[model samples]
Target: MGGFHRFYPNACDLRSLPVQEVDESVSVQEGQRLLQSGLLGGILLRVDDVYQVILSSDLAGEEGNQPLKTKAWRPALFIHARMPVAELLEQWMKTPDAVPVVADEHGVPQGVIDPLTSAGVLHHEFTRIRSYLDSILAQVNECICGIDDRHKVVIWNSKAEELYGYKAEEVLSKRIENFFSNLRITNCMHENKELKGHYHQPTEGTHVLISAAPVTHGSAVIGGISVEKDITEVVQLNQELTRASSQVKLLEQEIKKMSGQECAFRHLTGRSAVMQELIRFGKKVSTTDATVLLRGESGTGKELFARAIHQNSNRYMHPFIVVNCGAIPNNLFESELFGYEGGAFTGADRKGKPGMFELANEGTLFLDEVGEMPVEMQVKLLRVLQEGSFYRVGGSEPVQVNVRVLAATHRDLEAMISRRQFREDLYYRLNVVSLEIAPLRERREDIPELVHLFVQEFCQKYGKSITKIEPAVMTSFLDYSWPGNVRELKNAVERLVVLTEGETITEQSLPENLRRNTYISLVTTPAAQGNLMNVAVEAEKQLILKTLQQVKGNRSEAARVLGIPRSTLYYKLRQLGIPAKG
Candidate 1:
């Protein structure tokens, strides 16, 4: 039995100790190679049975006094094992000076390297190959199911887990055909031939692609692996594109269904359940002249709905005028809608053209940003709805043109009514037929549909053939709090379609603010906040209080730390019922 002194040299003469850098990039194999090279001495670098590296512990010099690296050596070997290396090391710590050996009969190495290196060769594999598998499995958004000749799952990746609504363990030995109502081909179990390639199923929204490879062991055919990839999204997308393409062709056929040569609704595609409800409502309300108050966040296609309503009404052929109440100047409001005579005011037209209200005679007029309409004009609007008569700016003659009113606003007019900014009478009059359109956030479940519509329309409109938003981009799009609402989303899609120059929109193509973190601000800051002042104040109070604990209890410093005025800070504390200092 050779002791440390035997491994070194000269019994009590010190020296003959090998020192090495612990953090060198040398792996276990390299370390073992060095040890087997017969350098100077054999010193195993392992923890228990598992060896990380085996180095030569030969040291230079000899004398009565010992070198620090030689004498101060409390050497131990560490190993990277299948189980926790540190745990294995802790278990076999027999003695302080005991050297861990692989076998008791003789010293021989078991496995002492990376688990992967132990399995495969050092072939040219991409560094991210593992990550790629993880990602493919992760991004396998389309739920997939894998089965064999017996219809038993040989591979149950995470996506299969998500798609089929089955846990991996639960479905591993089970048949995949049990879950799906329509498993396209029954030859999936045919022992004669294997199948390959994708199969598209319309209306069902499921694409079943089967690729089969025979399993052979000892040169005999046992069974086969069948990979089923669900491509419903891809099929739906293709259908949308096909629909958009055949619009003109289908228009002729669809027009024959209705009596009037003039169609009442223009085309905008939406097939999702919510949009279907909207479409149904649109068709139902279009035949009437009732005052429609369209309410939704900005960009939610209120104006589009309004147009559709007018086109479907009794006055389909009449002019449909659109006016943004917020965009028009306060001074020009009366003339913009009611129109002025030759010399009504300073820059009147010689012949005089009618306002949006007159232009929309016998048809429908869409009033956008109705929330921003001045309280002063609310009286004139009420007069029109009540008596159905209005005078031009300079003319005393009441215009007798019959018209329908459809007003829309992104703001909460009810809330505005409570604040005394909006007229309650006008609210009741305009809200004759109220349609509350939900924001994109509340309807996140409809993102796939919305994205499908927007991506298809915008790409075709902008001459960009981008088919889909990348998985990451779609994730970010769903996560982002679109304050500007659907309008913002459309603009983002347009921007991505134009700028990305690819078949898909990526997260990078979106605005900097949008491609960020998702957790909707639990607390709102004063800046970047909307009319929800009370919510913002409460949120700011919560954020300040939570951050205050980091510095213990220092109000003056806390205010400075919070980036708010000390006086303002005190006021906040008083408002929140939180005591200051004492």
Candidate 2:
């Protein structure tokens, strides 16, 4: 027994304990006498193949004459010999006064557990479990804080100390509200609810993703636990990134301004001397609020220049509304310029609509082909321009606006005014700062640049790869007078790029008019120094000779090709002193 006690301080099982085995024929009085002698721990009575435990304390004053089987032994809990120490201790602890009987696999009683040893084992196991829980709380990465029902801090893990700068010794057992006045852990416990992935700012310049839950034992609130992840560095980084982005944008805007690629006018391009001068002058004009009148031939990019002016102006950020006076019907002119109210007329907008002036408020209003406006409407337009206000079609209330007017036209407004077809006062009012845009022929140097620009533009659009234009084609382009101006030239280039089969544009791919013009330019270049009549005769003679040569000296075919009567061709042959035979 001394050897067993040294090897296993807390007895692992009852196998080595003292026991008294007796037959059921033994009288209960004899069983009690033997147990009271204190030589054994318990008495096991055997009847046939079964055994039952009878403790001496259970039969204290009963000296019955009946057999031990008839003794008054209360029901006992039987534990297996192989039962773990924790389980044995738990069973003994539940009914502390009842000594449990230990048995083997075959229902044979071994012995009874010692009450003193079982109590010691229970305390040892509880200490081991507590140490394990403390180790887990100390090593986890997330901040852990726990509070009891009294709102006192019960658990503060190592991570909590690192994040909140409060040691466990300093915070434990203290009211949590004293440390974090706005903590949601208290709210979680009060509401008896759980919070998952909640963002919180516990202190200034600190951010965290926190989760909290109330600890409950059988529907009764006992405490609460909260876990948090510190995200202060991440939040600071994001704020710094936003400021850096804003600074980069500001730098980019400043660079564009220094390089003359200002936001709105960057797309307008021209390098010719006349165009450069006009652009410079227009840029100066764009700084003021005075009315601007753009004058040019039809298709001379009048509207484009007007847009560039507006874009360069102070009102570039606002809208630039264009109203084509020639395109609007005379009857709808007033309503279109000055919008109508709701139910003003049949088919009008039900909620009313703003007109060009209202839409162009704080911006530029470009009245294209302004000469085409009816004389009556001209008076109303002049009045609005003078007063900066106008009444809607159906409403009597005057609508005031601050719009800069830009008028464009290809007609001679002075001539129309002289004929009384246009209002003279209106013409003068619109011509405050007249800007004459030169036709494409007058600024012929810009044609090549415009041509290449259009070529690159159309190549990408039509999926073509025409890289170069034949020298002859470029020469013809230079000589041809573009009556339709830049707009016409752009269309012609688009057509050529689309129709040309190969990677180069040649004279054959040009339109019929362009080809004919090229031939006339070829013949007229040498005689350009001669008198007007001499140059004209030389051009005519070269045309006739080239046609006759094409048909191998057939005069009738030559005359037919020239679109002239055969007799007139012969008379011109004698008149120009050409050989009649060939």
Candidate 3:
């Protein structure tokens, strides 16, 4: 009763069958009519709380006036309403009755169970299970092939069809060894052992990693099953990566050789006092794993400073990853910064991916245009900065990374904090050691050196031999306000080096804006109404001072700018009593 309790009152409902009740006096013809009306089995008689089962076959040959109880009928089998449906079926199967009466604990008739209804439920459940398994198998990328005891292929999935270039229909009944020579399916079956992680290249001309296991039935090996993964692209990528790594090593060696006599921060070239001070501070910070914030205008070489700091640090051998916060779409920002697990989204990689923080582990992560990062992301970033750990998108595990963060931005973060556009805690976290880069116009004294370096770089790149820059061109460069900073100067120098035809770049090679601005400055400034010699000398002194400022007190460049011999410029400086360095 305990086992049959769940099915008691409505055992017929378990198989979705209907119940038919009858009294002892009910005619056999009436029971036949009830069975024909769709009751698979009918109840014959009820005495004291027990109902007798009368099957359709028992009333088949009986006369119309004969009572059903007079024909063959089994003793009533009673079950409680709380009895299990499966346990009721088991007990019913042991009896001669085709149906079992269901009742509640109070002894009231509920329903009965019919065998036909039970079969329908099992069929539907098995079909659904088969469909679910088929869907999973069809979508899997690895090739799976199985053979039966006769060595004939019994299972060949879609991925197997794609990998071996054979349809499932062509291989279903075929012997696996006859079609695939390198599969070793026969050996696995005969030896009853597994072949794991074996690299194979079959005559069909495909690189695959194969693993095979013997299928067993009782104590005997029946056949074999094999899983194959295509790795041709992976192998090719590994070869290319090896070559790239070798080239990087050679480049590193060359850089080290060139930097043997110079400091690691030698690329930051300038004689300006502000430039020197920034360099000194950067060198000091690079020795430790400190979070640094670089504040500067666009194109002012903030990324360059970040790289210089990374290269001079103890973590130089590790990665220096740059994340452009502004370039990423807002919706994809979290996934891009923190990565995601497989199936995290529709287009995510199956094997999952490592995020920027994970990739920059034991290294440095430079967040360029950090101010453009969304407000919500700022809170997450602040937590990562404080905790040194973060969870991946759609993930639960916290990943720890020992990375030094360097953030750069052109926007005013202080104003952003007031507006609630940037997080205050994140601001303090990133600004642990803030450094500012002065704009090109503010440090005009660095232009001549910067120009020389850019020209030399581009000349070598373009296979040119240009070495000298015309003094008029230098004077014009110093006169203009460079709104685009050092990046703009580098581009202009590259253009001049590529287009100029002579060893010395002439003033005509300068951009039209620079030339026009110099001409306007000269024409607009009023001159004294006096002797021509006096006005010309005054103009010469002004030009000399501008040139000195441009070249950062480099006398040779100043003399060249004035179109006077170096000795003559020195003599005139002493005669005119103008400080030569200024």
Candidate 4:
């Protein structure tokens, strides 16, 4: 049999690797001492100018027997000292039990690069890579979390601690659901799939957009990783909007009539011509059983409009049920919309409960966030609308129901139809009477009234006696873009009413973003002296500063939420004389 040597020149250099060398004349006792001292992993020897490597095993029981010699000590496999570390590793892997000796061109022993040394090197490299990954995760602005196949928390970054209010030390090795029961990491791990852009509320008062995927090892899933973007502010704003919209609805219902024309739509408040026209159209549609689609952005009071339509309809006295299509899980859509029979599936109600269609029988069914409805459910809904009847889950008999379907959404159904996400048949069915409610920005004329309404509502609720809002504050309200629409405005008013100590709400009580955004109006102020450029620069600086503060000095997150590139944010920071640290 012939022995062969392998080498890879550029793979890795073995020259820097530590090796063990000793003269062949060393006694067995000395070799044992060297091995026990841990100064050398393996010993290299030169016998008759030929190299031999001796591991600790070779010296076993030889201490009291005789002096180390060619016949007594095992001759380990040998390689050239100049061989690349790749070849060394390959040799070690192929012959794991054999220690290797590195020798010169003249066959003189240089040193031994044994299995123990290679393992130590690999462990060191792994630690370095792990440390690098940890540092990278720390800098990321979004929350990053990971769980192993055992369903234990394995990785929790700094942002995760900030968002979820749990430290890595406290959560590591614990079941993920113990802290964030709403997190879908376990689901991803079990299903071995990915879920992105999912709206999640990990804990009360904390809302996030989560994207999670299974971490796989070839054909097997080893773990799961999730990234969550905090959207608590946006969600809170929308919630505030919903509350304010509800308050407005309540107030309108209290009034006997609003100029007689808005008697039916008193719940839908707006003095603008567009709003009045929309109200008139809503009232006209409310008299019939036509399927009406309320189109508007979130927090624009789409549900309120639907209720007004339902209340004014002939079946106003019947049951009016509201279903948020976006909030329902896809798997439960069928059972939720069309009631399931007893023992329909596992964990089902023994006695089938009525679905939205059955509950809203003979009345109006308001489907909010209809665009978020699954494509499969859209066909079923279309059939119900067209046939005026549908079968329940796990039932053979057809159930009849008279439901005036009123659909509302903040998404563009036309675009979704083009993308084939939404059905055109359903769109046509629901679009019999389409009303596009104007956003707060477009109907800025109604700000004062809406502000007055929200202030009174919040003031009465919070037990505050705030009666007046400063003109400047109101101007800021009008000038500032209400991205959350009426909801954002309502939230701002509520915030001011709660925070303000006096009877009057002032600019100082305004939220930081609201005040900073109104800087464009500063040019009109007496102190500005018409310095538009200065006013603009100061506004930009304040906006950047506020954004940075909101993100807790994370510039990357600030840039992302502000809809600007990270480099652009940095440039603006420099141009505006702000620190670049965060």
C-alpha lDDT of all candidate models, in order = 0.62, 0.81, 0.79, 0.78
Ranking by lDDT: 2, 3, 4, 1
lDDT, candidate 3, 393-504, per-residue tens: 8899999899999999999999999999998889999999999999988887788778888888998899988867766677677778888889888888998999999788
Itemize residue pairs with steric clashes in candidate 2: none
Sliding window of 10 residues with minimal summed lDDT for model 1? 6-15
- Name the 10 consecutive residues with the lowest summed lDDT in model 3: 1-10
On TM-score, the candidate that comes out on top is 3
Q: What is the lDDT, from 0 to 100, of the residue 240 in candidate 2?
A: 97
By how many angstroms RMSD does model 1 differ from the true structure? 27.7
TM-score per candidate, chains pooled: 0.44, 0.50, 0.53, 0.47
TM-score, prediction 4: 0.47
Off by over 4 Å in 1: 1-272, 461-463, 518-582
CA RMSD per model (angstroms): 27.7, 16.7, 21.1, 21.6
User: Which scores higher on TM-score, 1 or 4?
Assistant: 4
User: How would you order the candidates by TM-score, starting with the best?
Assistant: 3, 2, 4, 1
lDDT for model 2: 0.81
Better of 3 and 4 by lDDT: 3
For residues 249-290, could you state the per-residue lDDT of candidate 2 as single tens digits? 888656645543255454555566788888878888887898
Best by lDDT: 2
